[model samples]
Each structure stands twice: as structure tokens, then as C-alpha cells.
Target: MYPINTISKGGLALVLAAAALGVPLAAAEPDDGELWAGAESRIQRHRMADAVVVVRDALGRPVEGAEVRIEQKTHAFLFGCNIFLWGRLPDAGMERAYRERFAALLNYATLPFYWGSYERRRGEPRHEETERVARWCQQQGIVTKGHPLAWNNADPPWLPDDLDEIRRLQMERIEDCVRRFTGLIDRWDVVNEVTHFDRPQFVTIRAPKHSAMWERVGQIEFARQCFRHARAAGPHATLIINDYRTDAACERVIEQLVDENGRRLYDVIGIQSHMHGGVWSNAKIWEVCQRFARFGVPLHFTETTILSGQQGRGRPRSTPWRSTPEGEARQAREVVRFYTMLFSHPAVEAITWWDLSDYRAWKGAPAGLVREDMSPKPAYQRLMDLVRGKWWTKLSLQTDQQGQGRLRGFLGDYAVTVTAPGKAPVAKDFSLARRQTNRWQIVLP
Candidate 1:
């Protein structure tokens, strides 16, 4: 078998040459059925952990045969969607539906930080609006992430002509945003799409000024500066390097994002899987995870899109695209498979859907989990089944002679209730985490 490092470092040509000379290459890609056959086992092995709950009386004696109830309160794994329409829906009813549906299903929310729209003016940066959204997410017990602290997707119209000034302002913005929302928003996509920083499409139309600044500073330095600024401002923040490309170019960018000590500066590696054209095969999804898992940091599927309507063909159409019954069914099935594969991979930490609703979805593609009327689609319902039903943990157990009740469950926050025959039931909360000991001790009054 070819070493993964060898194949990643431009050694594919050697494999091809060997194949032509009657030499066998690495193992063939596994079929879909074969790949999925091990998914449940993988999820159990990697995502679930064992815990011991010990119940004691006020006199420090074992409370034998105490009933212990465990119910998962939240997932340690982040299942999320971008909340661009948090309160921007057309009407109050739609807005309520959006909030209710999002909170019911997801525990993580990605807030937009696109530079052009976020800060239309030089001194103003929409802090109040972003705070409002972040506050709402916090109230709903959701984790909030700011996206694309530095990207050339769109440049603020007031961006200065000078490259030096532009660079200064960009770095300042990163530091300011990270500092200002230090606790409310702790995770950020520090540098987005750096591999395609100067793509022709962006340079010519959408972000000419920002593209020019990126070219002047060089990609690696530009990314390094942005990450450094963010780290300086929010030292404990989770910084990510995000890109849509999953090829060697993206890998090269990640390899260079290190500090003077050669330590990785970013906390997470963000991969964008915008499957507007079609869903990726199971093998490809597994391959991407395998390739990036070498980096040692967690992987976040940051921007994922699977269309529930006919994909755009030839050129963009002016009419709105609507989700179909057949397409929604297909999307639901594909979403389950996609999420199952990613969740089973130990390296992947989070998956964020691109849009929450079909209304004003990116490029008007029917990629949301809900339809335009703010109703849940099949994809949404099926995902809810997996994330909350099959994957969630709820169990009842009785304490043994040693006052300890042992059980295995998916990692998350749990509410534990201990009830003894003649004593009032005692309630407490605890978290099951891979990094911490899962043993808990509860004292009954």
C-alpha cells in the first residue's frame, strides 16, 4: 500500500507509472455498501463512552438499589446550520418558524461576517445587529461561530486603494471582531478560501480591492497575519482555516499555517462541501476525511449544500428554484448517509448546513432543510431522526451494591436523577466528554 503521506506529496504519478508496469497500486476504494457496513460500529466506538454514577447518602453510605435516570441534554458533536435568516424572514410568522425550527434541531449556529455587507461604512461594523443574533443564539443554548474573518468574496466599497492600508484594516477587523465578541462568539473562520484567494471570477467582479490586497501580501503571509491577529485578540478562541477545495492546493495552504515554533496556529480545519451539482460518493467523503485527519486537529464540514430542486444548468436562471417531492426524498436519504459517514469519522467534530430555509438561499438553490414556507422538509425530519433519535441516549439503571451504576452513552450533557425508596429524588447535571473522566458522585440529602 502506498503511504498516505507519499500520495499526498505529489507521488500520484509514481503510483500511475507503477500500475502501467504491472505493479499493484494501493487497495481499491471500498464500495458504498462496504463503506457503510462499518458506520454504526465506528460511531459506537468513537462517539460513545462509558460512565459510572455513584449515589451516596448524607452519612456517606452507599444508597443501594437507587434508581438512576439519564437523559441527554445536548450533543457534544455540533450539528448546525447557518442562521442568516435569524430574524430576516419576510414576516413575523416566518421569523418565529425559523427560530423555532433552528433551535429545535441544531445546537450550533454560523453567523455571517461577510466583510462587504457587515461593515458597509468605514467606522460602523454592525456590532449591534451581530450582537442581537449572537444573544439570541446564546439564549437558545446554541454555540455561535463567526465566518470568514478574512476573505475576498466581497470587499467593502470603502476599502482603501493602498495595499498597506487595506492589509492593516483587514487585520484590525479580525482583531476587533474577535476581541469584541470574545465570549459570545469564540470560534471563527480566520481565513476563508485562501487557496483561491485570487480566483479569476472574484478578481474581475466581486472583490477586486480585497483580491489585490491578498496578491500583494502573498497567500501564506496573508493567512498567517489574519490568524495571528485573531489569536492576539482572543487567545483561547477556536480559529479555523476554511476552504472549498479538497485537493493538494488546499492541503498546501494548511501545511503552511504555522507559527515560528512550527506549531499549528489554527484550531480546526474547515472543509466546504457545497454539492450544488450533486452529492459526493461515499468513497470520496471518506477519502477527504482520511486525507485531512493527518493534521491532528478536528475537522469541521463548515458549509454543506445538497439541493432539493433541479440543479442550475448552463447559465443562471432568473426564476426562483423550488424544492420537489422527489428531490426532497433524495436529499433526505443522501443527507443521512453523508452525516453518518462524517459522524462516524473520529476526526470530524462538526457539520453545518449551508442555509436553514429555501427563502434567500445562496444562489436561490433549494438547498435548505426547510422549504420557503418555513416548514420542515423530509431532509430536516430525517436528520432530526438521526441526530436526536437514533444517536441520542436515554436510559434507566439501578445502583449496585457499591452504589455505582454503570452505563454507556453518546457523549453529551446529561441530567441525572437518583431516587431511593423513602428519600426525595435528587437531581443533578453532568457532562460526558472524551477528554474528561466520566465518573460522577451524587450525594442525596
Candidate 2:
């Protein structure tokens, strides 16, 4: 196996009445096997079904030279979750539990890079904390990614009145991040939520009148400059243009990013699927994918969250968003379906679930796969069933005359065991990257 390379949900309703009246209602959980099957159909669809490998005997001889066969087992997928909690949880037990649980399931994590938080005061960036998180993720074999090098929501407080200086500083910020995180964390949401500046209420934090930065330098230009700076610094990094809105305006921004020669300014198209209100219909989900797929670029569902509690109906923080048994059950079902849809789409490369625990989740909503107490919720187990349990690849096969055996399975890292008459079994590791043919040679003992 390649060395551990340091890389770097929906719910709703009905329960509100019960909670108000001090009564509870039960929510139905989808059949585990059925959900797994649906997810498998998408995960192992046309894109990934089989891998071709060759097994050699103890003497470094192929089946053609010495009869040999092998057994293969898939260990994990590149599936990921976000760790935006400044790299540590509150309670010691919770922190250990959180990291352990997170490492068990996810191989990727999205680190926070909000401008306001990282550099609330210019020249005093919070690098030490973020670096700690990135290193921890690396030690756990999880790839780390930085989010939104440029975002209006997390705008710095010490901006000058000059638009040119603001633009210059924004580029400088991107440069500093890409340079600092060169290999520690390469993937970045170069520009986030760029599609909707007019939606005043959507801004998560303070913003100047008329959204000064984007307006001063045309929105498109501002985005282009951010990407340009990021690309210059971290050419190997996966630069993404992300947004929460899936409207015509977003599509236009996507189209404008490509050059006259059809070269794109960004590497990935990031879409946020915050299902706090409720799960989106399959048709609507497909429509959004098809719309973005038109750009012919890889897509990443950057920030997805589904509540395991009563939705806040637009005031998630002020109101109570308690998780009920019914709500969690429903969340499990919807989360499975949502992930299945995204995985099946050929254009999608990754999906980062927004929150891991309900504790201090965005706006303090119960949107985590795990409860605050560090117990696995139905959604968490359901996802595990799809990713590592049912959809995983494990099988034994015999090699043909050419010392070759074909194994059809999910895309991930695999452990191959080779055994032959009078020869002890030997193990070898190989990986199946998405859309790439994986070939391996395993020598027996």
C-alpha cells in the first residue's frame, strides 16, 4: 500500500408539536440493507466495479510460472467529515472520542480558514491552532483541506477605506494561506459562497454596506484574483470555487471562470448542501448536479448538514433544536439517500459532511452524525454501513493463465492476501483511485 500520504442529511417536522406539548412521536428508520444497496448501486456504478491485479508466488513467480490466487479486502474510502472546532473538543473524553470516531470513519477533513477568525487582527493569524489540527489529522491518515480563502461573511475587521488596498490584501491573504499550507493542507475553497451577495440575511457574520469588496472589484474579478493568487502559490493544491446557492447566478459565475481556451480558473466546483430546513427532493438534487456538471469539472459537496433534531425554521440559534428519536431515524434515512445521489453522479469527487457532533454545531443545531455525548447516532451508523460495511469490497479469486485476476469492487485501499500450495499466505496493499485502473503484484511466502 502506498504510505500514509499526509494530505494533506435531512430531517423535519411533526416532533415540534410533541416537544411543545411534552409528548413524543416515533420516527421511522429506513431499512439498513436497502439503504446500503441503494448507496452501493451508486458507489460501484459504471465508474468503479472491478480492479485488475496479478498475484505472484513466494518465488516472485506469476500464475503463469507458478499457480497463485488471492483474496482482497477494501478497507476505506476517501469519504470525509469537517473538523472546524479549532482542532480540539471541549471535554477531554469528548475530544478523544471525537477524534477516534472521526478517524474510524472518515479519511478526509475540512479545516476552518475563515478570514475573520484566522486573522481577527492583521499580522496576528491563528496558525498554531490550525496547524495543530492539520497535523493531528495527518497522523490519523486523514487528508486536510482549508476552506474559503476569500469570503464576504468572514471579512477581516481592519479593512481600509481604499477598494484597491482591500483587493490587494485579499490576494495577499490567499497567498499567505496557500504558501503556509503548501503541503500540510492543499485543497482549498478559494472563494466561498460567492453567488449570493444580495441576500443580506444569509451572511453568517458582519458585512459592510452593499458588500463592499465584491462590489468594488466586480464579483467575478474578485473571484478570479483569489483563484489566481491561490494557484500561483499552491499549484498542486485542489483549488475550488464554492457556493451555497444553486441558482442561475451561480451558474453564470461558473461559466465566467473558464478562459477563452476553456481552461478553468479553479480545480473543483464546491456546493454546500445544508439541509437544515429539510432534505431536497431527488429531482431537485439531480437538477442541481446536472446544472453544475455542465461545466465538465469535478464537483465537491463541500458543506453538507442534516439535522437530527427539530429544524429551527430560520432561527437555529435562538430557538431550541433538540434531537428526538424520530428525528434521528428520519435523518439516517435521508442522509443515506442524499449521499447515494451524490456518489452516483459521475461528476462528484467528494462530499464533506458539515458537522460531526451535535454539540456546538453551526448555530448550535443538532446537525451532527453523533450526539453531544459522543455516542453514535443512527445517521453515523447508517453512513458507516454504506461506506465501510455493505459497499466495501472483499473477495477471493483465482488467477488466470496470464497470472491476472479481475476483482470488481468499490474504489478504495485494498489488502490482498496471496496463498498457494505449500506456501504461507502473504499480504500486500494496493489502492483504487477513482476512475483509474489499479494493478498490483503480490508475492507469496
Error of 2 at 95 (Å): 0.4
Off by over 4 Å in 2: 1-42, 57-77, 201-205, 260-262, 316-319, 398-403, 433-437
Per-candidate TM-score against the hidden true structure: 0.94, 0.84
Instruction: Please tell me which predicted candidate would have the highest TM-score against the true structure.
Output: 1
Clashing pairs in 1: none
Error of 1 at 438 (Å): 0.9
Clashes of 2: 2
Residue-by-residue lDDT tens digits, candidate 1, 1-445: 2212244754654355334322234566556777699789888977999899999999999999999999999999999999998878779999999999999999999998999999999989988999999999999999999997999988898988998999999999999999999899999999999897888989989999989889989989989989999999999999999999999888889989999999988999999999988898888887787677667678999999998988653224675578989989999999999999999877789999999898988887899999999899999999999999999999999999999999999999999999999899999999998756799999998
Q: 1-445 in candidate 2: lDDT tens per residue?
A: 0011111100122233223322233333224354345544555663365677786665766764333333334333347888975346777888888888898888889988888778889888888888999998888778889987888774577767676777788888899988997889999999887777645653434656225767778878778878888989988998899999887778778767865576889888988889888988765665576556655567788889888888644555565777889999999999888888777666677889988998888877788999988899999999998777666666777777777888777666677776666777777778866557677777665
TM-score of 2: 0.84
In candidate 2, where is summed lDDT lowest over 10 consecutive residues?
A: 1-10
